[model samples]
Target: MTFEASLAETLRTFQALSSLRPAIDRAGDLVLATLARGGKLLICGNGGSAAEAQHFSTELVGRYQKNRRALPAIALNSDGSLLSCIGNDYGYDDVFARQIAGLARPGDLVVVLTSSGNSANILAALAEAKKLGLDTIAFLGRGGGKAKGLATCELIMPSESGAACQEAHLFLIHHLCERIDAAYAT
Candidate 1:
């Protein structure tokens, strides 16, 4: 697609997301509440979504736009050694699940991002997170695939285009960060 068309599509996706403001606000509330209750976040995704997960984690653990105490957040995809070992020993699908089993505590939040919403590792991680009594959230595309029913809360982008969905995910991440910062920054 041409640059103009791509930009237009992205804008259209943003417009579609505007209708989801209430859900988005609820998601922000959930994150803030979890943090206030001393619960950290464990996030996972694949490929581009993995990068997005890391980005969100950094924003929470570091800073979004305001100076504040660091919040606890971890991206499950950040550890190459753990991923390799898990993938080698238990198969690739077990990577995030294994980590969640070890690291997640009750009341922690697990956020999974997937454009297809059907990635095996993400689904496995969600299942593990659920079993461990962690609240689960998903940022998904393509009608949320099988992960929709699994999430305690979900934001499913309105478009099937991976690029569009990913773009929307970034926007949501930033909004979440902003809310967190506004609510907690000292």
Candidate 2:
């Protein structure tokens, strides 16, 4: 495809995700509620999605805007030592779940991201989150795979391509960061 075609395709996918603004707003509200209730936010994913999980958590736990107080957001995928030990002891699929069980409190927010939306680790984590009374959300593409059915809130990308879906995910997280920052502003 030409550059113009690629650009148009990218724009098309973004336009599709734009339709999910209300749902994203709802997710922000959920996260804000969790924070207000003194519950931490936990996030996880695989590969690029894993990176996005960390990126989003960093925004929350650090500063998204200038001179903001830190919040509590943990990315389960960030600690290689914990992941390795758990995966070695149990199985790879249970790595995230085990962490969630240990760290997540009731009314916490757990955000799971998966490009295919069917990652076993992510699914297991979501199940654990639900069991622990977390407010769950998913960033997924291609019909949201199994995660859609499992999540309390889902942001499904309009496109089927991985790149497009991932782009949508990034934008969604950015919006969340901005909203969270504004919500906490005194």
Candidate 3:
């Protein structure tokens, strides 16, 4: 695609995201509240979404456009040893779910990113989060697939392209980080 075409696609995706303001705000509020209650965030995803998950966790645990105390956030995809073990023992689909069972607390927030919103691991993790009484949020695309109904708050990117969905997910991640920093900065 040409640069101009890419830019146009991005703009259209952003425009579609504008309608999800309420869901985005709710996600930010959930994150802030979880932190206020001394609860950590658990994040998981696949491929590019996995990278985005780690990026989000790093922003919270380090700093996000500001100097501040670290927040408790973990990217479940960060642990290669644990993931390999879980995948080996419980099947590949149980990686995130297994980790969630072991690490998540009641008040913590579980965030899963998936362009297809139909990854078995993500869906399993969301189900596990619910079983463990953790609130779940999904940054999803492709009409949210089956994972939409599972998330407490679903930010379904209004795009059919995986690239567009992933791009929008990163935008939402940055927005959430900004909101969290602003909330604590006060």
Please report, in order, the local distance difference test score of every candidate based on alpha carbons.
0.92, 0.88, 0.93
Error of 1 at 56 (Å): 0.4
Over 6-108, each residue of candidate 3 has an lDDT whose tens digit, in order, gives: 8888789989887999999999999999999999999999999999999999999999898778999999999999989999998989999999998887799
All candidates: TM-score: 0.97, 0.95, 0.96
User: How many clashes in each structure?
Assistant: 0, 0, 0
**Candidate 2 backbone collisions, by pair:** none
Query: How much does candidate 3 score in TM-score?
Result: 0.96
Tell me model 3's lDDT, rounded to 2 decimals.
0.93
Candidate 2 on 1-186: residue-level lDDT in tens? 788877887799998776898988888888988888898889999999999999999888878875577889999999999999999999999999999999987778899999899999999999998888777999999888888889889888887778788888998899888888788855
Query: Which whole-number lDDT from 0 to 100 does residue 42 have in model 1?
Result: 95
Please give the lDDT score for candidate 2: 0.88
lDDT of 1 by residue, 1-186 (tens): 999988888888889998878878888988998999999999999999999999999999999999999999999999999999999999999999999999988789999999999999999998998888788889999799988889888999988788999999999999999999898889
Ranked by lDDT, top first: 3, 1, 2
Candidate 2: count of backbone clashes, pairs at least 3 residues apart or interchain: 0
Worst ten-residue run, lDDT, model 1?
18-27
